[model samples]
Target: MVKQPAPDTTRRSEKSRRAIYDAALALVGEVGYPKTTIEGIAARAGVGKQTIYRWWSSKAEVLMEAFLDLGEQSAREAGQESYAFPDTGDLAADLKAVLRATVDELRDPRFEVPSRALAAEGVVNEQLGRELVAKLLEPSLQLYVDRLRTAQDTGEVRQDIDPRIALELFVSPLAQRWLQHTGPIDHTYTDTLVDYALYGLAPR
Candidate 1:
């Protein structure tokens, strides 16, 4: 069998990984995605370049993982068990809670700065946009899809409605408001979106 790293070595590796993540987030926020480089990350992280190479092959990979880790960190700070969406029986309440958490996250300076920079880059770079969508956005969107499917099964939603499309009814509005600065983003706003999307603007 191959030899494994010692316990202390594992701890050190973890420390280095955290440092790298922090450095990558900070640099991307400060300089934007195009200007951020692995060498800069290594320098800020106080690790050798080879250390980062051993873990990630490209700056995009490093930045992607860093953002993912930041999201997990935010979830832990919010006392969540993991990044998974809430699954309370009350679908509206669950969606509202998650959206409120999202509002908080969007308002956070650490998340907002780098996220804006990366999002701007994605608008111009089709390849990067696709990669980011696949790695980051799609997974989160799937949670909403899954919840909507459950609602359909239970008759909370119309049987013929598409879960994926139904999810966009609430989610897309919030995303557009946040990304475009067209309007405010808060619990009340998202609650309204959920209500309108589920119940419809016209009277039943």
Candidate 2:
């Protein structure tokens, strides 16, 4: 039989895990992904190097999980269910709400700083970029895909349209704006994107 950890032991582990996540995010933000070492994260987290190794095998793994954890924490702080999109039967409203939340998240220094560092590294490191896309970006994008599929089923979207491609109409614009600093990102901008994407710029 497998032994379960005691309640106090589990609490301590959770605390350590949170600390490690915070330290990993902070270190990556401060020094970029190339310089963020497990030893440095352990030192910042105030845990032994073995502590991190016991939970995560590589710095990439730790940083990935840390970013995911931060997203969940942000969602909770915003009174949202982690990893969920609103489905209030109004697709445009749902998309707008999510995009607004994303804008807020992008504006947050805690999220933006490390995210920019990782993104900069990803621009030059193809393997790491692919891994980050697979591990971090794809899952979030899938939520939009799922939502668009639901819209299609409800006749809110054209039957022949591809949900994945349709999503990019709104999503890609915001992503480009955020990544390139080409324009402002806010509720109005995203709302306009949703309106234009869903209804089209030309009259019906």
Candidate 3:
């Protein structure tokens, strides 16, 4: 008979931590943020509630980490760096590629379900909303600003354009469609956004 090596504490702890993240995401997705408690996450994760308390100060903290981890995992599985926005010199093409990917991600059940729950809750919870923007959204947005700045230096974008606000012209519309269900999101839609954003409505 072959004997198996005893599972070490680090391995066991890591397994428990992954379980906690999965449980927190699924619970919030299924039962909204307000109803997702540490005890519930513990029960779902099959760990003691004290284990959660030891790691996180609150459910908000746990959920935030879980969402961040989920984004990183998705990026890894997709074979891309998390939020490393593409800058291939052709600014419009780069923006279109990134936005198309965003469209796919926004439509994915695994991301959309939990994100919708958190986004809705954030609207009411000022602190949670601020943290969500600070911890996740703003970092990604800054990438766009950086790219736009590079475009400005290259003379692709106008020199006086505020990269931060200019980015919102394309980014915000897509986000609105996803969050508000105002319209369908797809590669074509995002491509159109990039075109319209880069070229004005005025005729040549």
Q: For this target, which candidate reaches the highest lDDT against the unseen true structure?
A: 2
Error of 3 at 170 (Å): 1.2
Tens digits of per-residue lDDT for model 3, 110-168: 89999999999999999999999988799889999999999999999999899999999
lDDT of each: 0.87, 0.90, 0.89
Report the number of clashing residue pairs per model: 0, 0, 0
lDDT of 1: 0.87
Give TM-scores for every candidate, taking all chains together and pairing residue i with residue i: 0.93, 0.93, 0.93
The CA lDDT at 100 in model 2 is 90
User: Which residue pairs overlap in candidate 2's backbone?
Assistant: none
- As for lDDT, the candidate ahead, 1 or 2, is 2
In model 3, what are the clashing residue pairs, if there are any?
none
